[model samples]
Target chain A: MIISYFIYFKLQESDFAVTIFFMITVTEIEKLATLARIKLTDAEKQGLTKEIDSILTYIDQIKKATLDIDHTPIVGIVHNIFREDESRVLPPEDREALLKQAPEREGDFVAVKKIIAQD
Target chain B: MIDLKNLTIKKAHEDIKSGKYSAVDLTKAYLEEIKKKNPEINAYLEVFKDAEEQAQAADTRFKAGAATLLTGIPFAIKDNILIKGRRAGSASKILENYHATYDATVIEKLKREGAVFIGRTNMDEFAMGGSTENSAYGVTKNPYDTERVAGGSSGGSAAALAMDGALAALGSDTGGSIRQPASFCGLVGLKATYGAVSRNGVMAMGSSLDQIGPFAKTVTDAEIIFNTIKGNDSLDSTTISDTTYKTKKTDKKLTIGIPKAFLKGDGINKDVLKNFEESIENFKKLGYEIKDVELPNIAYSLPVYYVIMPAEVSSNLSRFDGVRFGLHKDGKDGIDDYFETRGAGFGKEVRRRVLLGTYILSSGYYDAYYNRANALRRVITSDFETAFKTVDIILTPTTPAPAFKIGEKISDPVAMYLEDIFTVTANLTGMPAISIPSGVSGKLPLGIQMTALHGNEALLFKAGKEFLKE
Candidate 1:
């Protein structure tokens, strides 16, 4: 198993005997920064760890009153679709613009690092 | 004193075309209205400086007898939708400096139809949270009450429409983002059939569930915008135009279905139930049949949406590497500082979902979580297919309750999730659903949600128009 540092912490409180635990996984701390596409320093990670732990603790407390997952049912309101078969192309400029965002654009294609090394 | 603010798009368009009013004149009036109302409503993040220029162009088009139904109409789009040369932040600090390099497909289509994009509206950061409070920029206030939250992640879109800042606003829905916010703000919002509108340019929250739709004060405006943008595009392979047919009519007997399972849900509010029941009576009065139906599989939607949405989110958002786009935070002074960049850039909620998604789709847990959710989604889809055979459409409360105060449920994500119970089913099954204003007596407005099978969006439009008439 590939394991990374992810931890959770307590957060805030409420009434009605409902729990309010807000745990932040260590992996989440790592991942969140990745999403913002920002880099984090070791000291900041340490700070976030404390903050997430506290948040999780609060969330856990409120959730204590609610029934566990097995007890409650899931529900939704949308339905199935069977769409018509059709082919339409986006304008050339749109196609080209999307391709332009790629790190490497080669001859109307988005060039990527070769995933599989050729034998 | 006539309330031009209350005019529908059809009426406004007719008036504009007949010289009773000019598109430029209408745009100026609305611009003034936005200037008056925006500060208190907090519905707009930025009003376009080019708005007057665009209005001039629209007026010029109208005078030349080249006005399409949407000519010169000022509309604010959720900040997520890419407009060429404009900032599309997705309400996150990370993308604060990133300008949209190109217009999204919807923007292109709307621009072609002569719709003026007045500016960008706020949203939950990367469309993560149930309330606009999660926005990194700042919370978008509810139009009815400034202190209360506008429901999200498309909260600002709904608020813009509610506050009369724009005639209609573009919003993207993944799960209940559009409908729930529309319900809270007393506007019309739609999540079109999966793949109905191309998801080419917007910052995506979930690949399978994400869709670009509209929020308008009236149903017809929603229809007008939907018609203008709905089509198949090769850029987004998922979108298809199954039913090229379109019209809004309620002349015959239409069957409306209500899931028996939802009637007994633990989280449904009593006021919501009352509002929904009244809508049912109104539908009956309008000569429609309402029936009770059962779909035991409906319960799995939230878990499924959460599972699938996060997985896709983790994938789609991978492109925002600090080296390439938006805010770049350098840590440890090297290329690998990318991790630190995201750590500093994303908000707490966006991070949580990314981790949850990565964990669920990981090597060992994929089958147990992601695969199981996919199987459950199929069951949910089948259940809807079965119901549609018996009824023309299904009607439920858009959200389980009305707007909750800013801090009311922010502490408990699971409890706050109850607000999406009525809307997730549509996302899970890739169906078209609309939230329409049911009634409003005091500050709070109530909503009735209607869902139809794929490609049956025309039926939804017809049904929605009928509801508005009542």
Candidate 2:
């Protein structure tokens, strides 16, 4: 009776872990290819799923290695690589040259046919 | 047996200047090679319909004494980099017919020097995946082995360089896109110190991390192109406020750092380890000391990187709606057009990243995931600071293993991500990194990667110069 209880408790723990894994999957990855405009087939999805899980597993290693979460992520001792910002006037045809490449165009503005944002 | 295909850019340039080889002749040689090998290699997305015209123009420039460093040098640029009058889709269906509004900053620079762009190369759409498998067109196979992957997201550039499709190629490295593919395809690839190259018109993945790099068969070739492209630009504010080095190489007396965390990691392949060790021994014999340095936060880069990169990607890519630019899927009337266009245009991987990015950056979870990940990104960058102190350069295996068999790790994005472990720190910390072919392991070649801090590409180039066999 005690053994059965222990097994049941462990099963529950694993099930929760799996469920959490599913949740943090960042739904953005599913749409990443679309936003980037590429296609990944179903088999590719399975491959990426397994790969992402392994990466997450390895990431879990960081929790064990460093307890200090406040440490800054960027490391060069030098403070910044900022350069002086300068605005130069683009040549007249520059915009036209670029806008011409758009599939659909409005005069002077590259015409985009649709908005991808969701409500 | 003219050995024309084996000619280096400098050698070809010399021949062209001496009138021994016309730019047209050199261009024809490459086109013939592309025609012969591209079916099996698949390096080019589209062979220029007017390659002959472009070459003739180059020959004319030579006659007029208008040749620049890249003058008449036929090369390929990754499609992500814009070129005037060329379709600039980044291997994604949504922008399948998209063209450049203007030359990308690097393209502009190269163009001034008289570089003849043969065609655009393939990539993982939006420079997302480490392998070219994510492309909507088709997977770019390894040049070394047709059945294996040429590491991406710059696979096409690497493939083109390895098989002599171009004298040199340009690719963007957003997290090992340039270096890893160079490793898989046995070529030299460099990710300039962040902002060292202008990002004026390049499609961004993670703006903070994206860098334009070069692909070539030799370190010198890579350095030549790097020299031509590197400089401070008023166009990009993030470029090093001050330039790093005037020349492409650094003086010796440099300290090389080898991160223990990576050298002793779990996923490292045996042959990769062996080649890396052998190359280190050669370097030591050349009088450089290899010190063991520890960057503890290095291990967590992927999660932080994936989270932050996609979050930024979700934001940067928000512009590609069906309404304004790119491939439009016609819908009933026009309203459904928006829905169907993006829905049909974007591929699965692209959608996944966008959606994953969307979730992370969403209001409720932004602090825990996106903000925390950004904090971790700082931590990862800081860790590099502590390590770069005692060393001028860091060396590691470019990939955990050589080119994996096609479909071996394609299904597992995490495993594929792991393949980029050795190369990501460069992106994370905004350091310059280069991958150089060390030697062949089995049927494939292994790459040795070295990195230098901001404005220190000279060290990478200097080190890369010693290993050239040509």
| Per-prediction interface RMSD in Å | 11.4, 9.0
Give the CA lDDT, 0 to 100, for residue B130 in model 1: 83
Query: Candidate 1: DockQ?
Result: 0.11
TM-score: model 2 vs. ground truth: 0.85
Best by the DockQ measure: 2
Per-model TM-score of chain A alone?
A: 0.52, 0.48
Candidate 2: stretches off by over 4 Å: A1-20, A24-119, B241-249, B332-336
Candidate 1, B159: how far from true, in Å? 0.7
Local distance difference test scores for all models: 0.76, 0.75
Candidate 1 has what TM-score? 0.82
lDDT of 1 by residue, B22-139 (tens): 7777777777888998887778888998887898888888888888988877888999999997878998877857778888999999899788888899888999888888888788
TM-score of each: 0.82, 0.85
Query: In model 1, what lDDT does residue B263 have?
Result: 64
Candidate number of the best TM-score: 2
